[model samples]
Structure formats: C-alpha cells, structure tokens
Target chain A: MKKDLKFYRTLFISTFSLSAFTFGGGYVIVPLMRKKFVEKLKWIDEEEMINLIAISQSSPGAIAVNTSILVGYKLAGIPGALISTLGTVLPPLIILTAISFVYNQFKDNAVVNAALKGMQAGIAAVIIDVVYDLAAGIIKKKRAVSAIIMLGAFIAAFWLDINVAFIILASGAIGAAMVIYRERKRRRV
Target chain B: MIYLKLFLSFFQVGLFSIGGGYAALPLIQNQVVEINGWLTMKEFSDLITIAEMTPGPIAINSASFVGNRIGGIAGSLAATFGCVLPSFIIVLTLAYLYQRYRKLTVVQGVLEGLRPAVVALIASAGLSILTLALWGEKGISDIGSINLIAVALVALSLFVLRKWRPNPIFVILGTGAAGILIYLNI
Candidate 1:
C-alpha cells in the first residue's frame, strides 16, 4: 500500500507539472505526455496513449484533464484518478487566480492594456493554429462525411447563430445511424 | 443554493462539452447567459475575449471568471471544479476497461468514425469563435469597414506567420499595435 501511494504521488506531481507549463492544449500535449507516461514512466504503452487521446477527445471536458485522469487511473485506479485530476487542475487554478487578482488591481494600466492587446492577437493565432491542425487531420483522413458534418455545423453556428449543443447532438445521432446502417447492410450481404 | 446551482450548471457544461475547451463556449453561453441569467450576453462575450487573451484552457478561465463575477471566490472554485469533474470521472472509468476493450473491431470502428465527428466538432468551435470575433456586438456591423479590414489583415497575417514559423509573440505584439493604431485614429 505504501509503495502504491508513493508511486501515485510521483505520477500526480509529474503529470500536474507538465500540464501546468503546456502552452497549447490537446495536440501540443500529446508528444509531451507520450514521453512521460510511455517512454519514461512506462505507465502505458504508445497504443494506449493513442487510445486515450481518442477517448479523451470524444468525451466531455478538457483533453488535458481527460488524459490525466485516464493515465492516472491506468496507473493506480480511482485514487490515481483523484491525484491526477488535482495535479492537472491545481497549477492553472493557482496561476490564473493570481493573474486575475493582479489584473483586477491594474485593470486600467496602459502598459498592461498594451500587453493584453498583444496577447489577444497571439491568442487569435493560437486558435487559428488549432483549427488549421484539426482541419488538416480531418482532410488527411479523407473522411468526407465528417468533413461535411463539420462544415455544416460551422455554417449553422456561424451564419444562423444556432445553439451548438443541438448541432453536436444532431451530428452524433447522424454518425451513430450511419454506423448502424452500415452494419445492417453488411449483415444483409 | 446559488453556488450549488452554479456548480451543477457548469457540471452539465463539462459533461457534454466534447472536443476541447473552445467547444464549450456556445454551450456555456447558452446555459450561463440565456437560461440561468447568471451573465448577460454582452458580459459573456467579453468573458470570452478575456479568456482568449489569457493563458490556460478557455473553458476553465471562463468558469473562473464567470463564477467570480456571479458568486465570488467560492463560486469560482465551484464552477471550475464542476467544469472539470465529468471528464475526470469518465476518463478514469474508460481507462480501466481500455486495455481489454480497445482492440474490439466494433470499438475500433466507432472510434474511427468518431474522429471525423470530433474534427467537425472542433471546426464548429473555431467557426463560432470566428463569428464572435468578427460579428458580435463590437463586430464589423458596429465598428465599420475599417474593423473588417483589421480582422481580415489579422487573419491573413496569422495564416502567413503560421506557415513561416515565426515566433507567435511577435504576431501578437504586431496585432496589438494595429489595434492601438486603429483605435487612436478613430
């Protein structure tokens, strides 16, 4: 028991630290996580890591949080999950709180204003990068149905100001139906 | 009671908000702004702008900011945790069964299909952000043609810089300067 606890604690800290410093979310963290959990810790293999990313992306919540929980649980079960979640969340929570407090104090400072403006522009770039990468991945896979779904969703939300939840649910249902239809067709054949 | 409600609402947001942090925005807006009256649409939009400008995931930052605005520090903590809890629980559960179930052909096919959907989900998120950035209240409609030009220029510059692999900080600084220059001229 003591040995297990020690191992979990170490895993928690390492995972938390990596999450804390990661600049971009999701894909950017993939290689880093692969190194720590797969290469260094030997906690999970490469295939498991890929599987985790897939599951994490499909599930609700941040990918980083999902990844941590999955990895932590894989290593040490429920207790591992708790520790990993805390580790991933704590750093950003602390840092953001500090920044928010300071921001409130200096809300009107010109220099700070300038810096924020610059940061906003950078953020736009980051978001663009995220979109570009995701688009490239989908295009590479040549999934026309998925691409159509994405394009449709984007048009709906962008042009009509439709609620996003409805779009996602509708797309998910459509995807599931397509799968079922494919299965039935195969059986008939 | 309000704190609990806040917690539960954010929990729902976290529960269904797949893809990534940005994907949660429209849902967050719907729940917190339209349904609950916790924040006005304008405030929600501003919060998104602030979230984008800040580091960390947009959802968590929005949670903290919105929570702080609605119910102070305690509210902030509650909302933040709520947003994170679902993914935390679900991933853990899935991880346990992952080893045994990962190889099933059905499971593989489903995941393979889900990938494109996930991509679509993310692309929708990006489009939503673009809409907000370009056409929300302070958007091209109100800000005039110059702002539209600014948006186009920024978008173009971003695409070029991304291809060139220049340091992102420079692009950020440059955009800020442009915003300031435009604001000053106006």
Candidate 2:
C-alpha cells in the first residue's frame, strides 16, 4: 500500500495521544485502539484488531506497546513500527521525567504522605481487581486445565514462594504436555 | 555501575514477566527491594502508588521511578530502555513468526498455559501488597497496628470495580482524595 506522509503523521499523533491519555494499563487500550484503527482510520479491519490484541496478550510486553508496533508495522513496515513506538514512549517519558524530579521533593510531605498512604489500600484493591479480571476471563472460558493451573500457580507463587519466571515456564510445559498427551490418546481411541 | 545494574535488573524483569503488565510486579519487587536493597518495603509500596497514578505500564513507570531514585534521568533512560528492549525484540519476532505459523501447538500450548499462570502471578503479587498495606511488615510485632481505614478503602474500591467497573483513573484519583481526608487525622 503506497502512502503519503499524512499516514505516518496520523499514526504518530494518534498513538501519541492514545498512550498519553489512556491509563490503567494494557487491556484498557484495546477498545480505544479499535475505535481509532478500525472504525476511524480504517487502516485495519475488526478481525485484524482482534488478532493484534490476541497476539499482544499472548506475547510478552505491554499490550498497548505491542499493538502499537504491529499497527505501525502494518501501516509502514519497520519505520512505521519505529515511529509509533516513539509516539508510544514520548508522553510517558516526558511525564515520568517531570514527576521524577518532583517526587523526591514532595514524597515525604504531610499531604503527600497521607495521600500515598490512603492510596495504598486502593492500589491493593486495584491489583486485586486485576487478578480477578484475569481469573474471570479464564474461568468464563471454563477450561479445567486452565483452572487447575491457576490454582497451582497461585500456590507456587504465594505459598511456595517460587520464582514467577519458573512458575510460568513450568505452567507452559505442563500445558503443552497435557495438550499433546490428550491429542495422542484421542488418536489411539 | 548503577546504570549497568539498573539495565540488567530491568532486563531480567522484562524478559521473564511473560503474561502482561501486572505479571511483572513480583519480579520488580524482587530485583529492586530484595536484591538491590534500593528501597525499603514501604518505599516499594509507595512506588506502586506512584506508578499507579502515572500514565503507563507499571513496569515502565517503576523502572523510571527506581532509576531516577538511583541515578537520575540518565539512569531512567537506561533502565527504561533495558525494560523495553526484550519486549521489543521478542514481539517483533513473534509478530513475524506468528503470522507465518499461527497454528503451532507448542505456541498455542504455551500461550494456553501462560494465561492461568499469569492470573496466579498477579494474585500473588496483590496479596503481598495487601499484606504490606494492612499490616506493615510486622505481623508479630505490629498486629495491633492494622489500618482499618485502608481495609475499608480496599473493600470500597473492590466493590466499585466489581459493580460499576468505571474508568480506573477515576477510582484511583477518588481513593487518593479520600485517602487524604481519611488519613490526615491519623
């Protein structure tokens, strides 16, 4: 698809704004991205958007960053990926740079102390919500193996104090082994 | 030396946090708090708050926050880049390879297993933080000092999220304001 500079500019601006204004992390960006990429820009169809989300979720990294790169690559190849990533990082970098300077100054102040202390509970709750949200999605799918893995992983992580990296690696191995064994058994039957 | 350590720490964090943003939290805590001795447990919890209020992934925000604390903006850049480099390369390769072989069972199986594990990782991370929030690192020493207000706030936030599920930004901001008013007396 031959395109002009406007394509790149829009990709940059839209991604920049999305990364800037959107909060609450990766999952939050999906629908907003669809609205822009699918409905507004028509750069990608709905299925492609869904595919990007699936890929982003399955792969490592933040979903927002991953999708932005894919969308950028789709529009203009490697350079598009680079530009969109620049857009993605720019706002957060600037915002964080500014906050870093001030955080040291006001972190120990009275109001800041109370605010952070108060927010601590809320932060805990939010993390709980993340846990629930993810579990809900998996449970709704109703896969017994997935459910068992979730429970087992919780034990490994929380109780056993296993390293998270190893838990993931082990889970993936079990999951693959289960799939393979089941398939082989079915073929025999 | 600080910069190199920062890069390596975050690099390890980025490479292994397989599921999503929140999945990275435990690793972040380990590398920053346990290994590096950069921040206290309390300060680490506060960093989560700062990251929560910031406008990006918790991993990136904390990388920025931790780096700045250690070595200023230059450190921030090094840590941030280190945090993202693994993701950048992995995703690009996956995007390319996935398009070619979307049906590989190994690929599908790994993704399948990772989801539930990701859920577990997140829950584990949350409970630890909740423990810190409510009890403050001393179950035996300071059992009497549990913060009831924070507990109430946690209940309220969870209820709101479950029922309304509104924008998380508002929920966080609301708690901040409520936290100020409620915690000011304490």
Candidate 3:
C-alpha cells in the first residue's frame, strides 16, 4: 500500500471510529480491527493480523493502542503508527473530558451518588468475574509452575502489600529464566 | 506540580500495564487512591464504571477523567499523552525488532509468567473494591455496618453473569438503575 495522505487519512479514520465506538474494553476492538484492515481494506493479511494481535497482547500497555501501532507500522511505518495512536486516543480523551465535566457537576447529587453506589458493586462483580476466568485459564493449562506463580502473586499483592511493578518485573524475570533453563536442558539432552 | 504528578502517575501506569486494560486497574488504584488520595475507593469504583460505559481503553479513559478532575483539558491532555507515550515507544521498538528477529520465545515465556501475576493483581484489586463496597472504608468492624444491599447486588450480578453471560456493561447499568430505585425511595 502506498503511504499517501489518503492512506493516512483512512488509517486515522479507522482507528478513531473504532476507538470511539467500541465499548467494553481493549479486547473488544480486535475483531473489529481484523475485519477492517484484513477483510475490508485488505491492508493486512489474516495471518499477520493474528501475529499483530498476539504481539499486542503480549506487550505492555493497552492492546488496542499496541495493535494500532503495529498495524500502522506495518502499513506505513513510523508516521502511520503515530497517526493511528492519535486517532485511537483522541476519542476517549474527548468523551471522557465531557463526562468528567458532567460528573463533577453532579458529583454530590443524591440521585447520581445513589446510582454510582450501586454501580460500584457491579464493577466489583465484573472484576471478580475477570479474576475467576484468568485464574481458571492458568489452572487449566495444568502447569504446576504457572499455578504456583498465580498463588504466589495473589499472596504477594494481597497480603504482603508488595508493589505491583516489582511483582510483574520479578515474574517476567522468572519466566525468562525458566525458558532459558529449559532450552539449555533440551540441548544437553 | 499537580500536572507533573498526573503525568508521572499515569506514565507509570502505562509503562507497567502489561496484558491488557484490566491489568492496569490495580496499578491505577494504587496511584489515584492509595498514594495520591486523589480519589477515594468509592470514587475509583465510579471511575471504572464510567470507563466501562465509555468507549476506548480503560487506562486511557481513566487518565483523562482523573486528570480532568485534577486540572482541566490541559491536564487531560498531559495525562492522555503520558499514558500513550510508553506504548508508542515500546511498541515501535518491539515492532522493529520483531521484524528483524522472528523468534521471540522469551517474550512468550515472560507473557506466560505474567499471566498468573496479572490474574493475581486483578483479583487483589477486585477484593479491595468488593471489601469497600460491602464493608465500607471502615472495614468489617461489626455486622451491623455491612451493606447488605451492596452484597446482594454483587451476588445478583455474578449470578446474572454465570447464567446469561450478558455483557458486563448491562450488569453495571442495571445495578445503577437498581440503586436509583432502591435509594431514591429511602
């Protein structure tokens, strides 16, 4: 694909509209992106789209932002990446600005407060659901190491009050070490 | 100073929010609620709901809302930029490297290890939110203080989730409506 103004315009519009409209979370935007770029625009191939999604998931930061970066880069290099990010980010920034303004206005309203109080419980439930699904996924992998790490992480975060960044960094280091050790053992074998 | 603090706080959130938006919750809570006292736990829960109801990434939405609360549009811009900057740099570098070297098994391994930790962080965040909702900020000092309505809402939400598996947005909105009805009368 040619990296022209039109191409950049199209890229920006796609990411902007998708980010603006898609609700739920970061994961919800992936299929929509695949449809737009892979199926609709033919900008990216199906296989490469999957790879991009995997990379986005594995990398730090929001999946939507990361995927936009890779897709933008794949299609039009660095400028593409920047345009896509700005597109993806602008919608939420605008929307939330309006929302926070209104929210501040009604911050102390009795009706709004009551509704928010109830929503709080709902949000907590959603978080619990997420925790259950993620924990179950690790357990289902049937890897003792993964299971142990999950337990250890919960204990450290919940009970020990360890800083989360340290936990994540330590987990990543351990993960890399385990992989290196396994690779060496396989070579020896 | 507040703008700088907002930028740095969200910058850390963006840099460390591996996995996805959900994983960022605990880190964001730590920054906004625990360390900065910018938002109480109750307000933080409202922030999550607002993020859910709105479009785009939770982390992004949150930075904007919190930043706007602290400063204004300029503050929102500062925060939103801070949240996106790390991802922009990290992804650009990783994408360049990925094209050169196809084998990234170590990244996979790190993700694998990170998965469990992500779950744990999410769980810890959820538990705190749940505790705050049910027992209030004072904590479980007495049975009389427990908010049975909040507990019931959580149970109802979970039941609806298990049975229908409806989108969480509905559940959140439904609970909000329920709150209005239940509390308005009282």
Winner by TM-score: 3
TM-score of each: 0.80, 0.91, 0.95
Error at B114, model 1, angstroms: 5.4
Per-residue lDDT, model 3, residue A32, is: 95
Which is the winner by TM-score between candidate 1 and candidate 3? 3
Interface RMSD of 3: 1.2
Cα error, candidate 1, residue B44 (Å): 5.1
| Per-residue lDDT of candidate 3, residues A63-130 (tens digit) | 99999998988888889888999999999999999898998789799999889888888988988888
Give the local distance difference test score of model 1: 0.67
Q: On a 0 to 100 scale, what is the lDDT of residue A20 in model 1? A: 76
Candidate 1 Cα errors over 4 Å, as ranges: A1-5, A42-50, A103-129, A136-144, A159-161, B32-55, B96-149, B166-170, B177-186
In terms of lDDT, the best-performing candidate is 3
How well is each residue in A1-189 modelled by candidate 2, as lDDT tens digits? 456788788889999999898877787776888899899988898887888777777777667777788888777888998888878877776777678789788988998888777777888888898788789999999899999999999998778877677887899998899888887898999
Per-residue lDDT of candidate 3, residues B84-182 (tens digit): 888888887876677776577786678778888889889999998898889977767898888989999999999998789999999999999999999
Model 2 chain A is weakest, by summed lDDT over 10 consecutive residues, at A55-64
How does candidate 2 score on lDDT? Answer: 0.82
